[model samples]
Target: MELDRSGRVLAALSVAPALAMAGWLMAGLPLLLLGRFAPLPMLLLGVPAAALLCWAGTRQAGKVVEATVWQVAGVVAVAAASAVFNGVMHSEQLIVRRDPATYAQYAAWIAGHGGLPISVQPEAFGGADPWLLFEGVGFYGVDGGVAPQFMPGAPMMFALGHWLGVPFAVPAVLGGLAVLTVAGVVARLAGARWAVLAALTFAVSMPILYTSRTTFSEIPSLILLFGGLALAHDALGRPGWGRGLLAGLVFGLAVLVRVDGLRDVLPVLAFAGLLIAMRRSSRSTGSARPYGALGLPLAAGLVAGAGLGMLAAYLLARPYLSYLSSSVRPLLFICGGVLLLTLAGTAAAPMLSRIRLPRWAPAVGAGLVVLLMAALYVRPWLQTVTRDPVTPEDRRTFAMIESIQRANGMPADGRLLYFENSLHWVIWYVGLPVVVLATIAAAVLVRRLLRDGTPFDWLLPLAVIGWTTVTTLLRPEITPDHPWAARRLVPIVIPGLILLAAYALSRLRTRRWWVTAAAVLVVLVPPAVTSIGTAFTPVERGEAAAVEAMCAELPPDASVLVVERVTGDRFTQLVRGMCDRPAAEVKRAGAETAPEAEVRRLIERVRAAGRVPVVLAAAPGQVAPYGPATHVIALVTRQDERSLVDAPNGTWGLGIDVWMAVAR
Candidate 1:
């Protein structure tokens, strides 16, 4: 029984995710155990683990599971192409965004210092002060010490690259892995050809490209999420304790990366439970008892595996949980509730199997459940928008939209309208036609899954695509930037939609190869061209250059005060991360005094520490009191107002004046 092309592709696809997941998990263990995550250790442990998993999968796969050389080559080719494309588009310099800069610094510290710093005091001006808070660096000042606000998953990966002396290695590698995982899953569910197409579509997406270049959480999160889904699919097909446990572990690790992943993977738990419940339904009475014996261990393995995964995530992320105060309770409830439901469902599977219903009954129930969930998720956003005086965050976003509209010679009154149309921002990158088609394809897939009791391999993809699409469209709370806000959709929704579209195309009954090829090109070329164009477009370098100049003019041991009236604390982190300066921010808080008094106080404090004091201000008035006594080291003047759509909290290309107070 030599495997056909499709069988071979499916087999390879199943094995790939488990191998990747095992590799990442094995690689990360040392970080947990030794408090340092390095590439050499990761590869040393991970490669062997992956190879062993591959060997095990192959041995158990029997004669019907053999990927051809061409099939393997094709997957690798797509992954390599994705890696190259993302590497080329990688940011030449870090942008004004706080998160990416912070994550980079976190990685740098881990790479250089071997663990999370006891205090980011080294990066603080005049050393660590119990009372002083570091506003922009994204570190939590708690109990007289500072800790990184983000989870360690992304930083752990970045530490590997830093170890290798490659700045962009983490994103490049993870981005390629994400593409490969999507392709592999698509191959397993749809076919080998669609897998290739899905990988290409994801590689060319503008949002994907933009994210791949930066140190964002989405890429790493996607790697875990997709990898988990692939493994879970394999487990569903194989129905073994080992496979189930591995899937659970991968899913759990995803939560460690992004807490929100707990929401993304709920369906997997339900799917696993369903599999357990139905395992004995198809067996004969003679074999029913034997099958029932097998089902208990399978169910227990899955539950135990997932429980362990969640427990590991909680232990790893306990420190960062403080920063996510609002989310802690809900996340705990969701995890707890899902585990309980899985146990209950597994326990009651025999009873559930005895109950029969109309074919449409399950579909109807699922639809109602999805609607209720969507409504629950969207309620807060709806309430927010309906408020009389818009929230401060929304107000700022609206103002930015109005400014962009005014610049483009469009009506500035469409701020609310823009917010409403934020859901359609996907159209801006992939085109309206593709979005519409994908929506239709999504609908078709959902209908098929509900109507036909498809296997887990088929059901999981549709569930992911459908769930992410609905959630993204209903709750696009991010600022309505053309391609950037669309980033919220990139990790799952966009790629999922692309796969759905590819699957839809594959279903077409056309036998002509050219016809299929042309259809795929037509669907993908527009976005690819748009993404390529954006990739080549130079990043705004003026702001970065001005920062560099400021760093150069100031003394090596300068304690800089960023006095930002509009862009508060944004440049503080950038300066600290990029220029290796100990920086702080002076905002509307603190004592109200004359600018001269404030400048004198700041200068005296720095002078007491034997470091020079510098002020970087967004407005001239903020620095006016310093007078001619202060040297104007670097000034950046922009003709237009900086649009805050992409980075709502930060200002990019904004006019800035840098001043250095003359040392006494």
Candidate 2:
């Protein structure tokens, strides 16, 4: 009985990340709908229900194949050790400056209070005045209330961490689960022997390590995406539709975690269509209808999950959706077109299947992939990607790029995107072995996909990975800094390439054992070496302690008003979320100091409204005129340094100070 249950356990573990996340959504969504979102019920009821569901599905798989018991154990062991290490090294990003802090603040709010549209409590300032800007850097004022700047999926997951009183734990644990799932996918596709190597290579990469130790959306999204691949792979073997539905649900729900997830899963939709068409063709020929039932359920589940994500975005994150309207609108249109074309192809499957293609088609297809890669490789010499500083965000990015350029002793061309060097970015993190192996693997797989038309499982996984990876490399559209810009690659590009590299090495092992060993060393060494500089040294150290001390300085009923520019940008959400006090930053003209008369008027309004008016500034003198200023927070930390010309090498020092005073 013990031996028999091990396989089931491994199979269940393969889908554990997806099952756990889906369960949380299962519990949280209804609560969110009912305006009673809470973490306790999500943890107690949601997770267990998901485990039961996963167990039931595993049992129904009927002799599911998994890695050897020891291989599975090894994967689990690595994941466990990684979780401990990551938790210890996790960064404290409680104050808003970037995506990490934004997600943290959003989750903090959800954990404390279960509702949408976080209220700005305008009455605390005795109604909004021109000087009192309710909108913080990341929290947008929408519909007379404030909403976070990104999709709620990540914050929703992080909320569970918030409830547990260890917000960093979820990312660490999910990251481990991501490793397990990635290994499971490699085991099933490449071979069971490569599972441990895949796990090690994935965990040691800097992108994975960096995102795992912070509250980033990429880790959770990676877990869900790969778990969906594992589930979908299982569905191909099983006779039932349970695994298929779960696979599509998880894949589609990735959008809930990160809005880009919708773009990542487009191939799933296309793959489903292909399956439907193939099944229809098989029916006409009186052949086995392999994925007949599974295909429709997969499509339905995907639509349901993606639809739920969009609905949540529209209702809960309208400001964010509006901001992304340019890209989001086009993606939705593409999805619609893909769905319609798929339906049409399904109807005409028999006719399409009867038509024969040239035998050179598969080879040509493979050649095309190689050619495309070579083109991207040579792009840097031929063209330079740049953009006009049209939007405010674009101008800010220009300034940041200019600063990095000056610091790095490079020419001051802030407009240079350097996106043409994107392939080099992949090589930087994963090494040239991975790039070479992955390219060969992609080409060979494409040839097989076009000719033999079997191994139906690879269709969707490869399509999703290939499509997302190529597109991202073409247009990173980010700060062009190491680790910061690497977030774009971490979600799909890094892991996907690693999976392909494993597949290539596994295939090569039969011909040359030493070749496989040497390749493995080459593939894993660069990423491991790159991670050494800052892996043990945690970023943003002492930030939580400083924020706690600062929070202690303000009264519970205080209306905190920030007077300094940098302090206001960083602490607006921190004060509102962590301190549990109403807070706003006084608005000013570009680079102008806060006007004293206007600030005085704002303080009087707060006092008249029966709330203690607390003024805060980066320096004591800035707040001393209002009342007796008391130094509250003094922090010295290190942040990840910007690196545009090469791989990131070190950290930069960061210092923060806050002084507070209560108006009489």
User: TM-score for every candidate vs. truth?
Assistant: 0.79, 0.96
Q: Taking the tens digit of each residue's C-alpha lDDT, what string does model 2 give over 244-271?
A: 7888888888887788999898888887
Candidate maximizing lDDT: 2
Error of 1 at 543 (Å): 7.6
Instruction: List model 1 lDDT by residue over 102-153, tens digit each.
Output: 6776666666655543333433355554333355436655543445657666
lDDT of each: 0.59, 0.83
Candidate 1, residue 433: how far the Cα is off, in Å: 5.4
| RMSD of each predicted structure | 5.6, 1.9
lDDT of 2 at 83: 84
True-structure lDDT of candidate 1: 0.59
Q: Candidate 1 regions off by >4 Å?
A: 1-75, 93-95, 122-132, 280-336, 359-423, 431-452, 529-533, 538-556, 565-568, 575-581, 587-594, 610-662
